[model samples]
Target: MKGPLFYSKILLFGEYGIIKDSKGLSIPYSFYNGALKNDGNASEAALNSNQSLKRFASYLKDIDQDLVRFDIDKLTDDVNAGMYFDSSIPQGYGVGSSGALVAAIYDQYAFDKITVLENLTREKLLKLKQIFSAMESFFHGKSSGLDPLNSYLSIPILINSKDNIEATGIPAQQSDGKGAVFLIDSGIIGETAPMVSLFMENMKQEGFRNMLKNQFIKHTDACVDDFLKGDIKSLFKNTKQLSKIVLNHFKPMIPQQFHELWKKGIDTNAYYLKLCGSGGGGYILGFTEDFEKAKKALSAHKLEVVYNF
Candidate 1:
């Protein structure tokens, strides 16, 4: 038996900025997806996933029942019966693999679940974020719950700040357009906790805080607005700045081998590279007005185009 499918997500505009209340935008990436499945002859991967689910089920049991509760009995029964998350979404790649899993479990088994059909008011959305935050925290030590929310809703989400978020519509993708947003696989996993800790540690420095406020967040917010408004020129300009700031200030989060590649994009107008998620070594997000030019410039690497405009 296979449950509903939940897609992966990409934080187009915001990465580390949202923690400080920067405007953020996230879109659902239909390229990779996950689902809950119970297979008769569980493969090794399925067995491994089932074991993880057993532990996750135990964690859910102790979660705040006031916010949300699950059919722990049935969930456990399924787990014991070899239920597993059959997913193509890669973990630790910053594409919301765990978020998809959380969304699928919530969709399949949660009691008094919030249906996507209901009028999603600010209060309701906020409540969903809070519940998702709590539920997803079992995977990440801390979570904003945005990933699961985006995957569950299967739409673009605009993050105004820490307290305000809403479902938003982005400009239509031009199938034949030259400009594109793509992913460069680092081909290595990235850990969220360490990268986040490094950011927090950097927060203690006065100069770092100043730069984050004056440059990093400013560019990120502008990129969000530009993308939403469909101002391609302005979006590219701001994204260039954002990419540079990430390379200069958030160096540790970026993988070592890609450092020069990231810089090359900024130096030339061919493309702009930014952190996909925590960015130790997952998928590096790339934006370019001419996909052909960007691909030629970095022909050694593999590129997966997610959006075109």
Candidate 2:
């Protein structure tokens, strides 16, 4: 049986800032997607996914009493039927592998959940986020629920400031343009828990907070603005700045062995690298107007373009 499709998501802007209610923007990336499938011969990944889902189902059942949106019966039945996630999205790569799974569960199993078709007011969106956060927490130790929300909604979402978000639009891609935005596989698996813990520890330092407020957040906020306004030139300009700031201040998050390669891009002006998600490894995003140049510069690593601007 085929269930609804859940596409992978890219947090184009706002990684840690969203935690503090800073402006954030996310767009659906269609290259990688997942869906519910009932396959008789479960692959290794499928079997592992099924086990994870069972644990999540149990967690949902236990928490259902205190919560209101989950549909326990349907989820339970599906678990019994050997339901598993069949996805192309890579795990531990910060592309929302778990989030896609969570979104599929909500779309296929939730009995009284908010419909993406409804008005989706801030109140409803916030409630959905709360329920999804609790549900997705089984995967990530903590979650804001934005990943599943975006996957389920399949629309450009803008966080107007914290506590407020709504669907929005991006400028249509130019098929013939030379510029592009894409993902570069770091060839290393990034663990979310450790990286998040590191960020939390850094937050305890006065200097860290200062950098976040003055540098990280400022460039991030600008990138979001330029992206939405369709100011391509300014967007890349600020993205390069953000990439540099992340390289300098968030060194712990980047894979230590890749430090030199990361610096090479910035110094050479071939491509600018930034964190794709939580960053202890995973997929680091790269931006370059000239795909050919970026490809040549990053020849040793694998790269995938999401859009050609």
Highest-scoring model, TM-score: 1
Q: Pick the candidate with the highest lDDT.
A: 1
CA lDDT of every candidate: 0.93, 0.85
* lDDT (Cα, tens digit) per residue for candidate 2, span 207-269: 989889888888888988998888988988898898889888889888887788789888887
TM-score of 2: 0.95
TM-score of 1: 0.99
Error of 2 at 122 (Å): 2.1
TM-score of each: 0.99, 0.95
Error of 1 at 73 (Å): 0.8
Candidate 1: worst-modelled 10 consecutive residues by lDDT: 38-47
Q: Identify the runs in model 2 with alpha carbons over 4 angstroms from their true place.
A: 64-67
Query: What are the per-residue Cα lDDT tens digits for candidate 1 across 96-140?
Result: 999999999999889999989999988888888898899889888
Query: Candidate 2: minimum summed lDDT over ten consecutive residues — where?
Result: 62-71
Note the residue pairs that clash in candidate 1.
none
Q: Relative to the unseen true structure, what is the Cα RMSD of model 1?
A: 0.8
